[model samples]
Target: MNTQEQTQLNMLKKALMQSQYATVIAQCDDVLASLTSPEAMREARYCKAVAYRLSGQPDLALHDLQQLVTDFPDYGRAYQEQGYCYQRQGEDQNATYAFYQATRFNPALLAAWQQLEQAYQRDNQIRALQLAQQQISFLTSLPKPLLGATDLLHDGQLFKAEQVCRQYLQANKHDAEAMMLLAEIGMQLKVYSDAEFLLESCVTLYPDNDRAAAAYQALLSKLGKFPQAVKQARRRLQNQPHNMTIQAGLAHALVGVGALNEAIELYRTLLADQPARPALWVALGHALKAAGDTVGAIEAYQQAARQAPDFGDAYWSLANTKTYRFDDAMIESMVVAQHGSTVKLEDNIHLCFALGKALEDNKQADQAFSYYQRGNALKRKTLRFDISRTEAALEAQQQACQAPMFAQPGGCHAPDPIFIVGLPRAGSTLLEQILASHSMVDGTMELHDILGIANSLSHQGNAYPFNLARLSDAQCQALGQQYIEQTRAYRNGAPFFIDKMPNNFIHIGLIKRILPKARIIDARRDPVACCFSGYKQLFGEGQEFSYSLRDIGRYYIAYEKLMNHWHRVLPGQILTVQHEAVIDDLTGQVKRLLAFCELPFEQACVDFHVTRRVIKTPSSEQVRQPIYRSGMTQWQQFEAHLGPLFDVLGQRTNR
Candidate 1:
């Protein structure tokens, strides 16, 4: 909502409290008509419902509340208001259930907690009563600012919550809970290094705080520090031997570090005791997929669907194989599950993406696009991908990375690392597989070392690329060596290794400053094909731009412009490998790639499909098979629906 709309909304709330029901409903309708944001629409409906109830129209109020919760199942305020409607109608059981849902969605809802506490106590539910009482007591005991911030956070006002929490933390230095709240805010804001520091300090200051320890472990996993995540998870498991959640987290970290066999075993052991858990089944499927056991992965995914027909992640996991096709019955099940009143927001998103892929595989192009659009629309809600921020960073790179920065002999002379940089779905993984097939090259999953270094620099008051200008040659050399040491764990006694983090295209200037002797390959693909492919795939994390077609299109344009700038300032330093060219002439492309990297051409590089390694990208399965023409022209079918993508791209390949 805009400033005027927000002010009107506040006024409507005041009118509602003053018993001006008609005024509240009319103004809410006006606000709803003007408000385009999903959050604003929900707020308007919620206020209107309260107005209906206050004006003695219980049926209308219940109708509105039902629709509100139906559309947004996780709307805790709707649930709380629905509970009130039920309570007014003397429907005690319904009111209690609605209150339960309210608290389930938002534990910070004080009114909901108090109601639940009363309901539990009256029903003689001792355990439940104690839990509710504890929640109420804890909430009431918090400092007023923190309590307000908690409410704002739960209500999706992240910026406001951050501002309030930061203010509170400024006053209450080193308060564990305050630090935790700030850390949470930082994470939501995508300020990872700050969150890491806050959580790390919290854990160090209060060693006994398992909550802080667990948060730190989760962050480590998120940042792709798998070995550290493994250590953190193991420490937690030691403290709580039977904690299945921690063990499962450890299994995840194990998988991250290419310990697939061990991770698979751990998942199997967990499933053995909890066979009914669909999440365990889904997670097991991921490990199996990464281990190249496509058949086993399918079985695990199918079993998960069988266990819970409504489990969207299970269906999405199956579709993510890029080889699986959903049968009619499974599609029907998915459609039913998605429309169910209690389908979780996360589950709904999975279902949309899963359905999109399934329909696409079945050759229903228009229908597939519809689901893809819905999936992207839903995913966009939870992200913080600012295309402008990315563009600004790229602009800074162009301005800072002049020819002068590269004149001196600076960075580490280690020529071991080969960096494959590009957008996701631009064939970086395929190139990595081909290169790693060579005798001297090792294949590593997308490494966060460079991004982490840039993030660290940005956090230390000097942002990346800009920071490069101030660094002496010695400093650059030290950073370059630091990267080598950081990535040593992923090497297999090979003279060269591939860091195929696609988004590293944005950090070419940073990579140059640190690793001057490193081989840089730009994995180029058709603009339409690359953007559409990214839009369809459900990546585990990062690449937030993929959630929207226009955002991704803009990102690609920004990347292309940056690459052009890099080439201008550092001529002949980067090689561009076009995906289509590679598909058309594999041998010629292999020769070209090998020549650029100064490696001997080998038959194994041409036969990359037979090269065995831990591949994790969406194209992993496809790359395991021989090169095919299908991927090259797959975007054509969705050409009619590509306007959103192409609108941002000034030109598109002839359809």
Candidate 2:
């Protein structure tokens, strides 16, 4: 925003705070007329609409807010004002949906959350009401500055949020809520250790704060500290025997620890009392699928979709199973639910993906690609991804790291981790499954420890790889040991574990600097196939680059460049495994991979589909069956929609 527009906005805020609605409306109109920037105009329109609503001109307010939201879909204040206007016009359903959009866009909006709770309660929407209550309780405990930080975080302004929270903390040293909020921002930025330290401090300072405790446990779980998180959840549950929140926490932790039977039973017990909860049903379905109970999982997912037609996760869960087929009626229902403006942004995105899958299954390639494009476009609007930053980081790694850096041999000597790294949808999961099938290798979730260590050394101006030169041998060894110790909870006494975080391909130098003995595998696939596959899939979090075809292709180009640099700097350090090579010769490729990991060959590795481990990727169901060549050609069906990817890949697009 320009200086003049900012001044006008500040004046509008003051007028609204002082209940000068006429002044707010008039000033907003004048400022909007003078502003040419879309952002400035949106801000002005927001102020005017709110003033109109407060002045009892709700219809006019709704019209203006609707236009504002259509132009800028991520504006939370506009959605909240639209909710107010809808409520004034006696349209309770529209009001509820608008309120939901408000909270979804900016979770720190306490008023939006409270209004949603009341709307849900009035309509007796049991599951929605419970979720809104939990959100309200969580937000109400945060400090005011931290609440603003949360809104900034949700708006994809990470650096600004961190700055505000850090400034608040510098003045108020003992504020637990500010620390927790900052920790959350750290997690979102992929700096896991800072998040861990902050959450640890918050829990110590405010032991009675359940929200902080829950967030701390969740961070631990994300770091693959399953045992510690489960233990903490159990202790909390024991203290508060009737607390459903603690019970739910335990159920989630149990899933993390691979105790599928216990988790399923706990979910069933919980659902017996609150069967209307769609999220619980989705959780149960996940557990059942992990336990190889496909029929039971399908029934649970169907139940969830039936109870809450607008709950996008439930429908997406069914589609993500890979084996489940959406019937015609179900597809029609999704299409109808996605058409209205009042549908939540997330729900609409989910419907787009679900519809894409349904049409793809029916061989309607053109229609399927349309839905896929819409879904990606909608999702991309909410993410803060800069391709140039990624390219610069890769360039920095090439300039700073040389072959001599590896000659020092200055990291921890433990060969406990085998990392499978590459682009998403590039067959890393399949490789992990094969290696995890070995008795000596434990398969864990995508561990964030290495990324955490690398991110701690990064600054806004200087990317990683450039930051590694400042670390001494002692510091490197300590960081390596910290990773091993923190990840011990995810192991079952195996000699080695696999951390298959795909994005770790960017941090190969750091991984080698810290854990010199760790094995690295580069999982590669056809560029077009991989990028297009990622474009069609919907990730729960992260992987923002995959939401656009051009972004995905550019990311692939950078990834290929970095991997080539790694090979040049540290030759013979990484084992390159082609996805097609594995499919064509499973026996030989399995032996080659085992040789790279320095492990004895076993039948279990070859018969990986029957190994009975928990798989947590989009390819979960695909890996549960025998290896097939179908996915290699799946992208060809929509080749017309993938010209940008081919353009980026150039000669690399040859299949």
Candidate 3:
């Protein structure tokens, strides 16, 4: 709501509390008349409900309260009002239940708690009365500012919550709860490292606090620290062996750590106990797919679809496998689900992307692009991608890592990591697969270590690349060793492992300072094809620029400039592998890639598609097949709607 609307709301609330029912009703009507937003309309309706209740229209008040609670389940005041309506109608049991729900959502609702205590006593429920007493006690024990902050956080007023939390923390330096709340705000703001640090401190200072440990584990999982998350999950499970939630967390962590068998088994056991849970089936499908059991994965995905017909993730999972062909029934189901009101925005987005892929595979280019654009547009609403910020960061990388730094650098001489760095959908995974097929290189997932390190070094005033110049040689060496040690879990005993994190291209200078001897492969692709591919595809995370054609185009330009700088400053230290070149000359490119990494040529490199491993990228299915030229020009089908992309690519491509 706007400032004027909020002022009007406060006035209406005060009038209602003072028993000025007629005034509140009239003011609510006026506010509703001026309000266009649904949230504002709902708040006005709530005020109107209070006026109606005070005027002895209990039934009308109950109707409004029920509708409000239906629309927003977490609206504690609506539940409290619902209880009042029930109490006025002599429905003691219903009043008690509604009051319980009110306190469940917001424990600071002292009036609700008192009403609940009275209702429980009248009903002679001693245990429930004690529970209500404990809740009230807990709320009273918490600082008023912390309580207000908690309420604000629950209401999604993140900035206000952060302010209150910071104020509380300033007064109480050891306040773990306040730190946790601030950490939650940081997580919501996508400042992963800051959140991580706060949660780490909370867990360390309060080791026995399950809430802090659980929050830390979740943050680890979010940051893709699967091994660390699994460690935390294991510790939590040890203390609460029968906790199904913790067991599920452990299974998810297992999946992240590549323990596919263990994850699949845990999921199967969970599914057997909770057969109706579609998420478990989805998890099972992912594990099966990652383990290369395509048939099993298909069955698991189909089971998930059967369990929840509108679960778009299941359908999207099938489509994302890239080998699954959607039947007519499946296509109809996805389209219906995408158009359904019951499906959430996230699931609807998945349905749109799935339908896009299915239609594209069926030769419906127009419909495919429509769905892709729709999905990207929906997902882009949640991201904060700044083109200028990205360009500035790239410029910092160029400026900070001049030739002098490289010349005086003392980096860890560990040539054990083969870095495949570039934009997503740029054949980085393909290059990794080819190199990983060689005997010397172990194939790892897109490692988050470099990104995590960069995030750790980054701050509000100084982002990464710019901050790299401040690191001494000792710090650089430590960072390199940290990367190697952190990545040990993802490797076998192979002398070299492929870290196919595509965005790592932006951190090549940092990589040079740390692991200077590490092999860096610039996985280059045609700008039009690469950008359009990213536009059509839905990555799980990062690559936010891909949601818009213009953003991706500009990012591609910046990426090209940075890569050129790396080549100029480092000179022959990095190798460039063009996607089209690889497709055209697979054998020659394979030899070149192996030679660059100081490896002898092997037939396995040429037959990389046949390499048996867990492929995580969207190109997993494609990399399992021989090279084809069709995908190189697939962007041409959607050229008419790509004016923004072409405008950015002007003078660089023959548009």
Put down candidate 2 lDDT per residue, 1-655, tens digits, no spaces. Answer: 6788778888898898888999998777678788876666777788888889888999989889878877677888888888889999999888888888888788878999999888888889999999999988988877788888988887666888999999999999968778888988998887887898888888888888777888988887777667778987876776688887778778888888788889999999999999999889999998888777778988998899889888788888888888789999999888888896557788888989988988998999999999999999888866657788878877888888877887775778899999999999999989999999999999987877777677677753465677676678998899889989988877889999999999899889898998999999999998888899899999988888899888889999999999999999888989999999999999999999999999999989999998888877778888888999988899878987788777777743335
Q: What does the lDDT read for residue 609 in candidate 2? A: 90
List the candidates' TM-scores in order.
0.91, 0.88, 0.80
Model 2: residues with Cα > 4 Å off, grouped in runs: 1-64, 71-74, 87-97, 107-164, 188-190, 340-342, 459-463, 651-655
**Per-residue lDDT of 422-443 in model 3, one digit per residue for the tens?**
8898998889889989888899
Best by lDDT: 1
Computed on alpha carbons, the lDDT of every model, listed in order, comes to 0.88, 0.86, 0.85
Tens-digit lDDT string for candidate 1 (451-477):
888887876657666878788889889
**What are the C-alpha RMSDs, in order, of all predicted structures?**
3.0, 3.9, 6.3
Clashing pairs in 2: none
Q: Regarding TM-score, does 1 or 3 come out ahead?
A: 1
Instruction: Mark the regions of model 1 whose C-alpha exceeds 4 Å error after superposition.
Output: 1-10, 17-19, 29-46, 58-75, 86-105, 113-141, 384-386, 462-464, 652-654
Return the top candidate by TM-score: 1
Error of 1 at 422 (Å): 1.2
Report the CA-based lDDT of candidate 1 relative to the real structure: 0.88
